[model samples]
Target: MGSVQRAMRLLETVAAHERGAPAKQLARQAGLALPTTYHLLRTLVHEGYLRRDSGLFHLGDAAERLSRRVARQRRRSAVTETLAHWHDVIGAPLYCARYRDGEIEVVGVADSQENPAVGEWADFRATGHAHAIGQCLLSQLDEEARRDHLARHPVQSLTPYTVEDEGAFLRRLAAARHGEPVLERQEYALGTVCAAIPIRIGTIVATVAVSLPVHQADQLLPTAHRLQAEIGRAPGVLALSFSI
Candidate 1:
């Protein structure tokens, strides 16, 4: 086996011991020579992936951090796969976003060259009031959080159809019911219409959105409703992916 693979096997043996394992014990479990095991253990200790004390080796803080990062990466991959699948199913660009750390974050987008995603004419983070994705995410938050976000990113018009009045926007948000889709017509960009649905994953405020040409405006609401129904029927599959 390669040196790196052998070293990893030794580390795995040490980890399985929980409390710790002596060099000789790890070598026996990993089928490696005692000298080789000692060399790898020493190197791992120096690299912070293993900790040695009283002639025994244990998994270290760096190993735990690496495990967490791998988990996060797997979760992100699942989310992207789900969005891409929906993009193909709905035949439109799909978007996934969240309201994290008091800012709008577009986590991922699924689009092709022919059916491209919306171009960022204005900063999405600053123009939340003008986009369906932002409005749907903001609607899920409590009034205090919504106010706080608007305080930072004041509601401004990105297009003539955009809602510039904060009071009117708040009223619209109040009228929206859970599970319904939010629709916008040329609000964020001309010649495009978008729809977003509030994805309730635990206490987090997240959204899934889709966009199409203005000529296909009639398909906007029906497609959005179809998206909602699909989500409802298979909530655990797509919605749980969003939580990750």
Candidate 2:
């Protein structure tokens, strides 16, 4: 076998043992000569792909990082597919966002040619006060954190409908009852209306939102309700919220 194949065999053998495997045991399990196993093990250790402890070998930091990356990609794919499925079902653009590290992040969006998403003419991060995602995320934070975020990103009127008064905005946020989606009309964009509902998965706090052009403004809340129901049923796709 090639050196790479031999090395992979050794790695697979090492991974099969939870408590780690001695070089001789690894050689036997991998069907490699003892000297070849030692050489590959030394190289793997030097490259941070394997850890050696008292003559036993185990997967190392690099392997863990690779596994995490793979898991994150899988979750991202699942989220994208789920969004696309609902975009087709609801016939509107779908958006996913998260409140992480005190910032609003739009992680995924699904749209089609017939039902395109609203153009992001302005930076979403800087204009969280104006968008459904940002408003919904802000609503989930405690009063102190919410005030701190507003201090940093101060709410400003993006359009005529945008909430300009900080006190009024805070009151509006407080008024949104639990299990209700936050809705906004032509506030962030001149021609689009959106709605978002908070999603909590373990320690993760995120939002699933939908947007439609002004002509279809009446459908925003209904679309959001459908999205909330779909999300409630398919919680597994959101397990990677932190990864994105």
Candidate 3:
């Protein structure tokens, strides 16, 4: 890979580890030789991309600033505009979320109609198995990562419809990975049903969902499918995309 790509990769590696990984560990994880890793770390430390403390390297303040800048830019991205259009077309709450460092964060949301749960948008974090967006992103992870994530955060019963068992959760995730949207009825909330589809740049990278009252979800499926197709056609709607 080129120098810029390598540097970005190293930055991401540090961000992922968070606790300042050692040079040997960083080198092994990043597929670089010891000498190269040391040089890269030194350069990055000097350039304010990383910081060295007690022989371990952590992301510096500059890296955090860059991350916030990227998050702000993504909030204003074209994909978010398209998401708003989808929300308008469907008449339900639509959200765009991405998986970052083992958590799914809602980056964009649109709600034109008033709903009891619409305001919950700002509070939604994809860290729990009760969320459709979280499950969809988890479905994209490899087996080991998926298992580890589940172990770290076991399923909690949120409502009568919540999947409280590990086996069922895995089954639902498998179905979601096969392009089937997982629908939860009152699982996330008493009256809510959420249907989510994985969004990809090339494969699975994020998730977009339409959430509404359980009674309304059936009626909204057609509109949701139409919106989904439009999203699939929109340029750069996903973090990954297949070029035709």
Candidate 4:
């Protein structure tokens, strides 16, 4: 077998043992000669992919990092596919974002030339009160979490229609009925209107949104409700929140 295959066999053998395996036991399990196994084990340990302790070997920190990196890539691919599918079905640019660690993050977006995405004239993260996506996410957070986020990215007017007062914004969020989509008009960007719906997966808060020119204002609420219904029917595909 090639060096990589041989190394993988050793790693698989080590992984099969819950308490770790001695060099001789690993060599037997991997079907490699004792000297070759020792050399491979030394290399693995030196490279930090395997840890040697007392006479046994175990998977190391490097292996954990590799696994996490692979998982993150897989999650990104899945999220991209989901967003693109919805964008095609809705005939508007679709956006997905999450509230993580006291901040808003726009994770994925899918748009086409016929239906271009909204321009980010202002930092979306800092203007949560001025856009549908951010407002939807903020509405899902608890009082303390909401307060914490607003403290850092306090309510500010990005356009003439933006909500610039913190108390008025908080009261508006409070009065919003559950599961209702949040709508904005020239709030974040002039001549653009948007709508967002909450995508709650357990305790995690996320949002799915769409933006269009002011001329399409009449279609905003209808599209938002349709998107909400689509999400309700197949929440598994709409939710991009993943375990890190």
Top candidate on TM-score is: 2
TM-score of 4: 0.89
- Per-residue accuracy of model 1 over 1-244 as CA lDDT, tens digit each: 6999998888778779989988888899999998888889889999999998888889988998997788777777877887787888888998889888899899889998888999988999998989999999999988898899999999887789999699999988888988799999999999999999888777677888999999999999999987776666666655555555
Tens digits of per-residue lDDT for model 4, 114-199? 99998788888999999999999999987787788889989887778988699999988887778889998999899899999987
Candidate 3 lDDT at 187 equals 72
List TM-score per model, in order: 0.91, 0.94, 0.63, 0.89
What lDDT score belongs to each candidate, Candidate 1 first?
0.87, 0.87, 0.72, 0.87
Off by over 4 Å in 3: 1-77, 113-127, 240-244
Residues 43-107, candidate 2: write the lDDT tens digits.
99999999999888999999889878888888888899999998888888989989888888888
Clashes of each: 0, 0, 6, 0
| lDDT head-to-head 2 vs 3, winner | 2
Instruction: Please give the distance, in angstroms, between residue 36's alpha carbon in candidate 2 and its true position after superposition.
Output: 1.9
Top candidate (lDDT): 2
Candidate 1: worst 10 consecutive residues by lDDT?
A: 235-244
**Of 2 and 4, the candidate ranking higher by lDDT:** 2
lDDT of 4 at 204: 79
